[model samples]
Target: MKMRARCCLIALLIILNWAQQAPATEDVPGVGSLPPEVLKLLQDLNRQYGPDTVTLVSWLLDAATHSGSVLTASVRVTGNEAREDGTFLVFQIETGLIFNTRVFDQSGRLTVLWSKILAQAFAHLDTLQIPADGVMIDLLYHHKAFAETDDLSEHVDEPGSVEEAKFYFPGDPLRAFLGKKLSSPALLARTQVFINDTPVPYGAIRTETANGSH
Candidate 1:
């Protein structure tokens, strides 16, 4: 009797945890699960890179429509594939990525909130695979408070302003891929650039003076 009770309790806890970590469908059904454009982009990405190289760098969510819409998605790592030799996929938000070879068997595969994953991914970048549709990849979404931008007021406190910064990016997906391997906090901390605050003609500074210190 005691063993049966323990098993039942464990099953109940697992179900509760799953429900909390991931909702049935989209958080809000009417919102329509990421716009057509967004879905197209994700499809193109999966088709192009085979879900091994493309990643979600950062996600930006806003209270719009019924619930929220993925505003912008940023991808940090990209390649035809993770490289024949294979490479590491870095997260812009936190650190590590959870990998699932059989992604579809799992419903909510993308779930992880840890900084250690970030450090390890970067460290062992040479040998790792991005989980496919059925595969699972842990990410840093719950600990969003650690990121400065989680709070609007806390944004832009780091160094540069968004407008002044110019970054080499494939696309911004902070809004599209929040809890996935491609999106990471650490990568975002390094990638985002406030372009407005940047000096005009940054690389092409005029050499009017001999020093060229513009």
Candidate 2:
């Protein structure tokens, strides 16, 4: 009888261990359950890049829309169907603002391709009745290639690297930046550039600079 009781105790302990190790389930919403505008934007992106290539990886929405209140969405593109492979696209959901950090070509520079992608996202987001003035763009630049699992924050604070540039502008300034006529200097003048969380003058970013150095 003691042996049988010991066996039952061991079984109980095993069951308890398994229960502790099991993942807890939460009521997380699926991609399809996103807001109608957001869902449409994702669908349009998927169609543009081929079916099942674009996936909504993560998002944070504002509890209530207010100035400086931000909603962000992180999207991943799988396969080489588009030039955005291995890159994550982050969007300001409220303002239709978007940007990506991945360097697309051998030039190792931010290119017009980003502008085009931003335009596409903005077109869909413009339809939403949200405050455009609160829209801001925070761009991350790095010499290293980002793996699919890499966290962006890890690179932002790396010493000696000017990894971030932020711009606070309404739709018109953004439009001007996207337009061919507007020069980068004008955009830079309004931009608040940063290096390792330290603020730097916009002029520190030069056309010929590499590795985000002045």
Candidate 3:
């Protein structure tokens, strides 16, 4: 009888251990269930990169709507589909948004934010397939705290002003991208020009030479 009890105890212990080690869906408010594949991919991404990547991904998953008009949905990462153009990952941000990719690409704010985020965590990812929707939706509406802006135009010093002039980027998403890629003033200054609908310029230097007698 004692041997029988011992065997039962061992079986119970094994079950308990297995239960403790099992993986579960991450708890995110307002977010729906994530596919097992997506959860696994997220773990891999977090392990390879860091928490920032995870945080950004989490926000994307949890975002439900923007401005009460644009709809958001749970995202899925599917296997790469081979193509002659290039290899790419298909991130289906829900079936609803797939047709609207073109609209979203037009917004300056959204494009800047999306480009910056991708560069930080997914730099190695050369090609990506998102929803075909052409609207920016509400990706950054509530996450503005993460978005930053520097209006250095007002701080530009006059010809004789003692104050040092500064370069400012008015775009919030650009600021976030700069904050991630640039660690020093020199790097930021080097990237002062970028092409948009037109050439956007930042920073100006005024030089004066003393008169010389012939």
Candidate 4:
């Protein structure tokens, strides 16, 4: 009888272990859906990032846009599938603000609180053409980056004003801006921004005449 009891205990342990590691069920009738409460949680998380930060106040289509004060965000639901790492909903966030150092970690499933904002860490608008003509927010970069290695680089402030600024040379607009906005003035990574044969944005500003008067 004692031997039978031990055997039963062992069987129960095995069953529990299997249940614990049973792959996450993402499609059990709305288990993975972005329900109202979950959406509210994401907004609250962003609030921890800043006072003006927010998410969807109202539901919209899969191809939707979310905006922040210093940035903008857009998320596109691609397909109907179980939750899996790298099965992204797709987001695009942009900014023109300078002097910020934001760290983001939004790679999760249930709580799509999947975004962060760094207003003061932004850089390099003088060199990078706005990807599109509009405001953007909290859209995290999808690439990994190295820490800054230097400490004497000048900061790039004021979009469309500075002549030259530090950045990760040869970077696309997104990378170029982050390289300067986030890491400049500290000489991080020996990064520098460079033009890639694209024409610079044009604007009109008051200029001194040949006679030396504005």
Q: Model 4: per-residue lDDT, tens digit, 1-214?
A: 2233333223323332333344324222322344556434443433332211122111111111221222122222222222222121222222222222223121121012111122122321223222222122222322122234421112322222211111222224334434444332222222222222222221111112223111
Clashes of each: 50, 0, 15, 19
What lDDT does the true structure give each of the candidates? 0.28, 0.33, 0.30, 0.25
Instruction: Give the per-residue lDDT digits (tens) of candidate 2, residues 25-130.
Output: 4221333344566445444443454221221111111111111111232223222211222222233222212222353321222232123333333332212211
Better of 2 and 3 by lDDT: 2
Model 4, which residues run further than 4 Å from truth? 1-31, 35-71, 74-93, 96-166, 169-189, 195-214
Candidate 1, residue 139: the lDDT equals 25
TM-score of 2: 0.31
Which residue window of length 10 is worst by lDDT in model 3? 158-167
Per-residue error for 101 in candidate 4, Å, reads 23
TM-score of 3: 0.26
Off by over 4 Å in 2: 1-130, 140-165, 208-214
- How well does each candidate superpose onto the true structure, as a TM-score? 0.24, 0.31, 0.26, 0.18
lDDT score at residue 162, model 2, on the 0-100 scale: 27
Query: Distance from true position, residue 84, model 1, in Å?
Result: 14
Which has the greatest lDDT? 2
Return the candidate ranking by lDDT, descending.
Answer: 2, 3, 1, 4
